[model samples]
Target: MPKMKTHKGAKGRVKVTARGKVVAYKTGKRHLNYKKSGKTIRLKGKKFVLFKGDARKFRVLLPYDWR
Candidate 1:
């Protein structure tokens, strides 16, 4: 069988923690920061856990991350 390729974009942005959960940075941090409220910007700094329902789908996209 051929080696499965990692979704390059997902690989770059998402991380699998030691416990095997998928985590990714919150969106909306790339532009127009000046107009955003301080709290909104702060929240964007944190990593978010992908929901189980959604993770099931994302898992397929990130086939290289073996459990």
Candidate 2:
């Protein structure tokens, strides 16, 4: 059989946690920060877990990593 291929884009942006959850950096942090609230900015600094529906679809792309 052919080797499993990793999703390069997903590999760059998402991380699998030890418990098999996908984590990604929060969005809206890339631009227009001056209008964003302080709390919003702080929150954007942290990562968030992917929803169950999305995770299932993405898991197929990231076949090798389960976390």
Candidate 3:
């Protein structure tokens, strides 16, 4: 069988944690942030785990990252 290729974009945007959860940075903070609330900006800086449904899809993209 041929080796499966990892989705480069997904690999860069999401990460597999030690416990096997998929974590990713929040979006919507790149531009026009000056108008956003301080709390919103702060919250966007943190990494959040993907929901079970989303994580399952990402797991397929990151075939080699079985962490």
- Best by lDDT, which number? 3
Better of 1 and 3 by TM-score: 3
RMSD of 1: 1.3
Reference-based TM-score, model 2: 0.89
Candidate 1 Cα outliers beyond 4 Å, as residue runs: none
Candidate 2 — worst ten consecutive residues by lDDT sum?
58-67
Q: Give the TM-score of candidate 1.
A: 0.85
Predicted candidate 3 versus true structure: per-residue lDDT over 1-67, tens digit per residue: 9999999999999999989999999999899999999999999999999999999999889999976
Please give, for residues 17-59, the per-residue lDDT of candidate 1 as tens digits.
8787989999999999999999999999999998998777778
Report the CA-based lDDT of candidate 1 relative to the real structure.
0.85
Ten residues in sequence with the least summed lDDT for candidate 1: 57-66
Which of candidates 1 and 2 is the stronger one according to TM-score?
Answer: 2
Show the colliding residue pairs in model 2: 17-67, 20-67, 21-67
Q: For each candidate, what is the lDDT?
A: 0.85, 0.90, 0.94
Alpha-carbon runs more than 4 Å astray in model 2: none
Model 3: ten consecutive residues of lowest lDDT: 58-67
Candidate number with the higher lDDT (2 or 3)? 3
